[model samples]
Target: MSDSPHSTDGDTSRATLARVAEQAAVSMSTVSKVLNGRPGVAAETRARVETLLSEVGYTRRGAVVPGAPLIEIVFSELDNEWAMELIRGAGATAKLNGMGLIVTQSGTRHAPDPEWIDEVISRQPFGIILVMSDLPPANKDRLRRLQIPFVLVDPSGNPAPDVPSVAAANWDGGLQATNHLIALGHRRIGVIAGPHDVMCARARVSGYRAALESAGLPVDDDLVQPGDFHIEGGLVGGTALLESRDRPTAVFATNDLQAIGVYQAARALNLRVPEDVSIVGFDDLQFSNFSSPPLTTVHNPLYEMAREAARILLDIRAGSPVGTGRRELGTSLVVRESSVGPA
Candidate 1:
């Protein structure tokens, strides 16, 4: 057989594979095992082979292999309603396109575990949708070499530029929420912000500050409290703000869960909703509407973002060009009974 390199239909060349195997000091059979996602290879050996494969730019056929009609969705955890909304959205889209959905929970917000990519290669799904999760460079290289497409549903608001992603307009949501409070004749507004490390949280805080400044109100540093996007964070932050000698008439919690915590804090302090202190929250979660004196919050459009991310992944899989590979959905304010004009 001729050793001259050539590619047909985007499949890796045989000569190139031979070179990769030689450099890794492995036989062609061992390389084939790694390429096919078969067992019997040592972990270190597999990683070395994968790195070499990536270095040589070995890519599989672009077309999906026969019998693998699956689209996988990855999340850090599945305990909350947020994950459920995303699953529903992506699952619906996948079914409509004649594919099954696979849900995987692995790793933290930064990236998935090292072995997760190997499992994915074995499955060889049609595409992948990652919600609030990222992949390391080696894993990314493996996916590229396999011609598998992936998209991120990034509520965190920080996504890699080269990858396709869909995110909500978090800053705009924050601005709208704060503006609503100001329009209700509130002179002092407090914000319970999410973790400072997250881009979405920082963007929301910036928006709140902008709204206060634009409305000719002072941006009091004391009114800005740290949170963790959870009820406990909200409770702690809300308690601190409410206990102050000169407390804010209105408060904005970065997320719905935090807002609920604020409610608990207010109740413990013997305050009535929207009477003693008006409140607003972000995310517009389903439970937000069921709270005593329903929550006035921002509609985050999590379901829509998931659907769009799945669509983009499918489009990439179909060999279509996606310009910029980034989409930001708009947010709207949902007025409920929880916020009112300060007395």
Candidate 2:
């Protein structure tokens, strides 16, 4: 008599689960709880079960429902046009794939809230799109155990090497902005940099420095002022640079909001834009074009980045071989009226 195929599959499933439980030193119920993402299992036991599951390539059976699949996109905050662009891009892709999108604002720029992972596991969405740089290792392991895929958009800092991410060409944007100013004969250039700790910020600043060096210009520490990717930081940094004894004729704000702040700073000091101080900003946001004298800026491709991230997540769901490395979109310089030959 031949063994039934159903019997063989059932036996194999049982054996695998039992082996996982034995190795984790937990009861079958405990293993089930960990697999289901229930609250009763002890943290340590849950971790052990998750690790063993990953090792054995055990995925929860039938976790994804047949209809009403969703793709969750989480953000640290959604106050600016930057977030809007990302949402538009990802939402459009999700719609085309016949999936609904769930947008959430939870935790900080670095990682999502602790409880967010449990909720996600329970929901069992098709995939996740996180606009954060760092994800906790435990959360990553849990997602892997359940076979839920995720991709990062514009990661805040340096994420793990294996995490899939999409971002703009910050270094090139910085270099382009600086080189554009240099081409206009502005030798003494000032840069209002973003937060020092952010990876994109660091890369942009480095590009600025590289441009100056390539032009045989000294990298003056005093000319590089700190910003917070906000208007206030630009206002403060721009004011200080403008008030210096040897102020730079051109200023590059790391972001559009800071550029607006720079505009304000120049106005308060009765300095005419371009005529008094040439300005360049990043992230060619919509409002940047409406600013007086129209802001010259770098196009950061936020929409494209988000679209690519959504595609990557979908590819993971389809079992396609999307690599773990970052997919960087290009950035270009959009010169309007803000930048000009230095007076």
Candidate 3:
């Protein structure tokens, strides 16, 4: 005999289906048949079950009930094209599996509110994906008690050893971007780095320093300007580097938005890209391709990473074993018109 559709996949035993069955005052098997569109049930009984299912917003594992649970996507902020790409990928995957994806913001805080967690527990979602944010330990425990699976997408900080996370190869990306600039005969290289608190940013900058060290060049603290990973941060950070008496011939903006900001700053100083200054960036956001001179960037594969994360959650929901560890996608340098040798 096949597994019963009435049975759920997780420890979430208090399913909406159970309540619907209790309210309809019918056998769970009868309700299951109606829910799955299986025949051989009385028309009156089926109608009752359908009505109760609607009233309760519940769907059994194989039920064709509407308003089924969604896969939640929690984002730190939805202010960038890269964030949209993550949504597009996860949404596509959820749709393919006959599920819908819902996006929620983390608000001004990097993590969502406790009330938000209460709401999520009430909804009893299939799973959740956290993008560029960390979950509080208490919330993590609550989710575990509720048997809700969650994965992190490019986690913003250092996650615990047991957390499941998907991300791009930040270290290699940083190494390769700086290596490309080095190959172009640009010795005075500067870096407009992101906040030190972010794990990816830290890894990228570390790779930059490693590359310079490997080439027998001294790592200069004066050449590294730390900023938030935004266009405005890039503008301020890039300006500071550019105004220095010993300004670098080539500079790397750790993220693409900052790269665009660097471009704006370059224009302000009457400097031409690939001529008076060279720039490289990371994340390869769609707009990078259409920028003034096109960006030389490290492709971070945000969409693919998000899609894989969704797949992992699906497997977990299906009671399949997904390893608990950081999963890293590869990154590579894409050369464009914005980078060249020192003038």
Tens digits of per-residue lDDT for model 2, 1-343? 0132212245656677888899988888887677566788777888788778767755533233221277889999989889999999999899999878899899999889888987787666778889998689989877876677888896454656778999888999999999999999999999998886788988889899999999999999999999999999999999999989999999999899999999999999999998999999999999999999999999989888888988998788777899889878999999999999987
**Which 10-residue window of candidate 3 scores lowest in summed lDDT?**
59-68
Return the top candidate by lDDT: 2
Candidate 1 lDDT score relative to the true structure: 0.84
Indicate whether candidate 1 or candidate 3 has the larger lDDT.
1
Q: Arrange candidates by lDDT, highest first: which order?
A: 2, 1, 3
**In model 1, what are the clashing residue pairs, if there are any?**
none
Question: What would the per-residue lDDT of candidate 1 be over residues 84-115, giving only the tens digit for each residue?
Answer: 88989999998999889999998888787667
Tens digit of per-residue lDDT, candidate 3, span 302-334: 889889999998888777889788888899999
Please, what is the whole-model Cα lDDT of each candidate in the order they appear? Answer: 0.84, 0.85, 0.79
Q: List candidate 2 stretches off by more than 4 Å.
A: 1-36, 47-61, 65-68
Off by over 4 Å in 3: 1-69, 155-157
Candidate 2 at 289: error in angstroms? 1.6
